[model samples]
Target: MNNNSNLFLCKATRNTYEHRRSSLLCQVCGDRNARNCFGSVSCAPCKMFFRRNLDFDLVINKCIYDGNCEMHENSRHACRYCRFKKCLTVGMKKELTRPPRLNQKKRIGKQITPPLIRRLDLLNSNRSKLSFDQWSILSNVTHVYDQISPLPKILNSLSQSSFPPKKRLRIDGATLADMLGLIYRSIYSFLERIPDFTMMSIHDRNLLIERNLHNVGSTSGLLILRDGDLYSNYAFCRANLNTYGSDNFEGVSKLLNRLDMDRVAVKLFVVVLAFSTCFDVVRPSNMTNNIQLSKSTNRLHFNTINMFHIQNKYIDMLFIYMVYRYGYIEASLRFAALLFTALQLCVHTMEAANIQEHGDMLDTIIADTTRKLNVEDDPVV
Candidate 1:
């Protein structure tokens, strides 16, 4: 047969295989075929669909049922919006996305600043070239974040909320919602206090805070999990699930199982997250026809160039720190593992936000907090 006929037959064969495999049912659809995509179990077609369309900000179909469409293997394609929501609902982790090409720098060559160029030089320089100020800044950022939102306090809260291993666990949805807000607020407040962050425009500052809040929360959540609370799976601090009417025990358990609990590596990873520029506003995809690179977007992009260098510099410092603490091979492995964790955290945070019943309410809280901060010139505490 010709190429088109052969391709049709191949697809038909795969569909038959999918129908025969009951054990591989997709979570997004009831298809008897599934493949692991991101962090969730999904069928190959669903996985490919999600891979191509994960960014919600991009223009897409509005669910006719208003995001309440029924999904089954045959009907899953009926509503793209509801289907994507289901993808997140079933815990498909976005961080599981294959790393994008490292050619973003090439797209923004004209936007690169002189300061950023110098920082890149410093980043490429030998470990021996590191100066005292670099260490001081890195140390200070870590210290201040810890001091502002003490991990011990979060761990202590988890311990307080949790019951004995054998006891039945009850999670208050309201409390979970409140805790999520608290964590986001703490992290946003911390981000604002990053040295020279205040120098940026208010719009850009808020944009950055909103964009990176999930990552910051994920880092905080992982840190809390790294403590002894993983066994309990009751995250009252970062990603709280309400066990009142539903079961999240298995999901939370799986999440904790996925975390890499290296304290030093995680600390450096948190610094990396603080400087993440992976937001739709910052890095709109080439496939995102709906998103326009307006003048404001370009301006924000330029502003973030400095921020990117700052993050890159810290990342370099992390590489050096890891190399110093562990041998080269181990450090490389740890860094890779940490990067995966960071990616997982990004996906986890998004899923967590959707799973929580109070997700939109929490966004409202952040919005109000942003307005308050913007209106009042009080220093971020």
Candidate 2:
């Protein structure tokens, strides 16, 4: 062969090699720029998608098609079943996927020492009277509560609002839904972070949420108002009035004004309310009619003994902490007052839920939350 022909053929071979190297495609979705993930060549999105849905066998079985739908970059998200099937077909290894929560804990551990660890040092110095377990519960619950509380955000928003702080701001249905949704989401997120709560059976978790989330949320709302100095803010009171009506709104404001605003005590009390089997507080006989307005119809088949055990831990912690903070006699009076306030909050929440617009909004939020929790609780293979 001539010299020029030899050079031309070499150039063609080099060009082909570069093209092949640059065109790496995801094995599962045929997307370019792929890299090894879970033992297979995949794009970032497919990697995360596989990791999230790894244990959801039911999702894979419920394919809309014959379970062989074509999966490419454009069509991958259209059918999760086929996408997941293709991931497996292409040699993706479930064993290579890590538990996300474990990874999250590792990251958190590296970033900052947990509050429980700090409290351990205090216990060693004999400065703390609570047992190690009680301290652990208190630390975990308070940390999670701080992380999930919407008070700061609400205060910032209120500060920046066009209306004056003292002006009575009108709240429409959409505004009410958004406010309620935010509070409910915060409560659910708080519960999800508590290891004991999340460890419960999915049935029990959903049951607890349906029966008691709003009651807990009502107390949460009161705390936000007390802490944010919104109880007397005409705008806030007016908003509550629009949603809960005159009597209930006034009662909520009064309850907030009466709270002593003990941060730790209130946080523990919120956790206590969360695990309570039922809110059995004194109210007028006429209030019994409102039971029909509640959205939850499913009777509790939860492990009553186990739940009571968990709840008792928090109740004990609260009592001990209150005693530590305020003497026994005062703590007893304060505890009784807290229970009465909770009853009032429960009554007010029930009245709010009875409103047609509020009821519909709450029903939607509950349905969506339950669906998401079900997805999270799907069994791992």
Please list the C-alpha lDDT of all candidates, in the order they appear.
0.61, 0.73
Cα lDDT of model 2 by residue, 1-381, tens digit: 689999999999999977875688999888887888899999988998898767657552455445565677655654456677888889998988876798899888888954445544543443246898878878988998888888666544433344542222444556656766777778888999998898898888877776776788778777776655555334455666776788987787788767756878888898999998786232222234455543333343569999999999888789878877775657788999899889877777787877887767666766777788999888887
Give the number of the best model, judged by TM-score.
2
Put down candidate 1 lDDT per residue, 115-226, tens digits, no spaces.
Answer: 4345545434453544698678767877776677644444444434234422213335665555555666777666667765677667666666666666666566666554
Check candidate 2 and list the clashing pairs: none
Off by over 4 Å in 2: 1-128, 159-171, 280-299
TM-score of each predicted structure versus truth: 0.53, 0.59
Among residues 3 or more apart in sequence or in different chains, the pairs in candidate 1 whose N, CA or C atoms overlap within 3 Å are: none
Best by lDDT: 2
Displacement of residue 92 (Cα, Å) in model 1 is 42
Q: After superposition, how far is residue 179 of candidate 2 from its true place, in Å?
A: 1.8
